[model samples]
Structures are given as structure tokens and as C-alpha cells.
Target: MMMKKTVCMGLILCGMAFGTTAQTRGSLGQSDPKAKVVLDNVSKKFKSLKSVIANFVLKVEGANNSVSDSKKGSVYLKGAKYKVVMGDQEIISDNKTSWTYAKDVNEVTINNVDQSGNSMTPAKIFTNFYDKDFLYRLNGETTEKGKVLQNIELTPTDKSKTFFKVLVDVDKKNQTLARMKVFEKNGNRYTYEISSFTPNGAVTDDMFTFDAKKHPGVEVVDLR
Candidate 1:
């Protein structure tokens, strides 16, 4: 009778241990639990960030041995509308009307009225997370420049086409977003590094509005 009681106790303990392990991995692979922890901090930190304008240096490496380019310019993003002025080529997305204007080419490309997840601009990290339906996962972690970071991936449950996967390097200590990597469907990869962040700044809706009349000499060709 003593032997049987001991065996039953061991089996019960094993079953309980297995149940705990399975429940933990149900959220993710249990590799980087801190990734989920950092994402949860986003909404709380930026609740006061309504609109922002920032200057950023961008480096783009296209996958499949495509054209690799580097860009340095200013970005003006207000609410869901934004305009990126890089060289003479301007990208303006007004939520309702998305337009890409190239001065050298003298052509304007118009996007669909209801384009989803099209805005992967750097500013999205500050403003767009307020939406409630984003899905997150802890991909893994890596050490960059001697700083330990957790690679957190986000997939929008509503709409997105900017990339197939987005991997963000989250600071292990401060839980702040350090850098981000985007893998697009066209085999192009974009890596963005945030140097400085100014939260709760002054930004007006007019900053997002694009007026062709402002640039009278530049030709605008609508390619919707």
C-alpha cells in the first residue's frame, strides 16, 4: 500500500508540471518572455502622443539582390496622414488619398483609397499602436552593440502590407524599442534605427495635408 501511494503522488506531480509548461508556451515559444512585456508597455507610454514630426535617416536594403538605397530626409506624420520629403520625390498619404510624387520623373502614383497596413513609416511606432487589435509574438533575442535586446514581432489583425514580418529589438533593461527590422513579401528588408524620440510634441493636422498648389512648378500625375 505504501508503494502504490508513492507512485500515484509522483504521477500527479508530473502531470501538473507538464500542464504548467504547456500553458506558458501557449503564448509564445517561451524564448523571450520580455518581448511581450515590452509591447504591453507601448500603449501606456504613448497615450499622450497624438501627432509628431521628426527627422530620420533611412537605410533600405532590398532582398533578392535588388537595388539597395539609403535615404536621409524629414518625415511629417500627423494622425493617420503623413508626408515624407526625400529629395524631390515626395510620398504623401492622407489616409483617404495616398499619393507618391516624383519631381524628376514628373509622375504621381496614387494608391487605393482603402489601403491597409500600407503605413510602415517610422512614425507608426509612436502613433499607430493605440489600435487594439495588434497581434504580437516573441521571436527571439540578440545582442547588438553590447546591448541585449529581445526580438518582438508584431502582426496586425486588421490590415497590413508593408512587410510579412516585423522584428523589433526591445531594450532588455528599459523596455524601450531600440530598433526594428521589416521583411517584405518582395524579398526586400528594411532596417530602421531610432536615434532620438520626442513624445507629446506640437503637431497640427495641416502638417499632413498636401497641396499641389504649394509646388506649382512640379508636375503631378495621378496614378490611382
Candidate 2:
């Protein structure tokens, strides 16, 4: 359960790595002007902020539209580093190495970061996902609790991709991301909603790395 949840979280950051190569993506068209404008604004917002901390709810649904499970978690993202906490599991990475801690099992796994640039991390997405893999367009607008939201649809350029589409909701007034929904070809839907967002939160470097010494009696499996 912990591993699956961590992978789901990682998928959001590594969407650009799936399926096709950059050369094969040449035939794709430019992003729709409207969508480009909105995403550009969002990228700028992320750049101006020092860091980000958010609480989120993740919902997983089956092909029949029935909820398989739901979990609440918090994430801290700062540049190429991030830490995710859900239930008794935590995934921490510093763009160089990663650590997965499963408290219930009293175990930790360590591995080196995949430096191939084939995968996009959360930090990479915040900085520049608009330039690759997807062609996006405005999906119209809707109001939530009286707040206006601009919905944008992103279609993967490669039809062979596991997930065909992604929907992003941006707050029109604040120019911040509100929610994201990913639809998978396997009939699984992943919905991530941000319940709280704090920009420029105080973050330290050590927070992104894990130290097994801090947790005595934990088994360490080093895969590096």
C-alpha cells in the first residue's frame, strides 16, 4: 500500500517520462495560446515563491466510477526536493538520492536518483512541464464556492501513453493551482486536491534527505 501510494505521487512528477521520446514528439502542435498564457503565469508564480507546503486529498477510483480508496497527505516541495507523508509512509528525495520509509514495517529503502532527465520530478514540473509531452487547451471555467476557476485540459502527445488526459484547475484570481485529475488507460482515475497551500514556507535542506540513524532498529535496504 505504501509503495503504491508513493508511486502515484511520483507519477505526477514524472508524467513527461512515460511512453514517447522527445524526437517522436516533434509532430505535436504548440500549446493553445490561452492555455500557454495560464500555465506561464503559474510557472512564474512558482518561481517567485521560495517553497511550497500543501495538504492534499488523493482519491483513487475504479473503471466503474466506484471509489477504491482515498487518502489524505501533505507534501513539501522545494526546487528539486520533496517529501511526501501519507499514513505511516514517507518518501523523501533531494534530487540526488531518495528514501522511502515505512514506519509500520520499521524499514527504509534508499536509492540514487534517476538522473537521465527522462523523468520529470515535481520540481521539474513546476519549472517547465508546459514545454513537453502535452498539448493543452482551455477547458472553460466554473465557479467553486463563489471563486472562479479556469479549467485546462492536457492531452498527451503520444497516444500510447498510459494516461490519455489530465485536467488542471487554476484559481483565476490568485493564479494558483487548485486541483489536478489524471485519467489512466487502465481505468484508474487519480484525483489530487489541494486543501491548503502555503507559498515561501520555511524549508531546510536536511528535510529532503533521510537519516536511518535517527530511527533505531529500522532495517536499511540500500539499493544504490
* lDDT top scorer: 2
Error of 2 at 111 (Å): 1.2
lDDT of 1 by residue, 10-101 (tens): 22112111111112333432333455566766544544456555555455776776768665555565566666666665666667776666
lDDT tens digits by residue: candidate 2, 1-224: 45654665565446424432443555776678898899888888987887998788888888987658888988889887898888878889999998888888888888898887766666655555755667889989999988899999988877877888889898888788888888888788888787888898888989999988899998888889
- lDDT of every predicted structure (CA atoms): 0.54, 0.79
- Runs with alpha carbons beyond 4 Å of true place in candidate 2: 1-6, 12-20, 23-28
Question: How does each model score on TM-score?
Answer: 0.59, 0.89
Indicate the residue-level lDDT of 22 in model 2. 40
Sliding window of 10 residues with minimal summed lDDT for model 2:
15-24
Clashes of each: 2, 0
User: Which residue runs of candidate 1 sit more than 4 Å off their true CA positions?
Assistant: 1-33, 62-68, 110-112, 115-150, 153-165, 171-176, 184-188
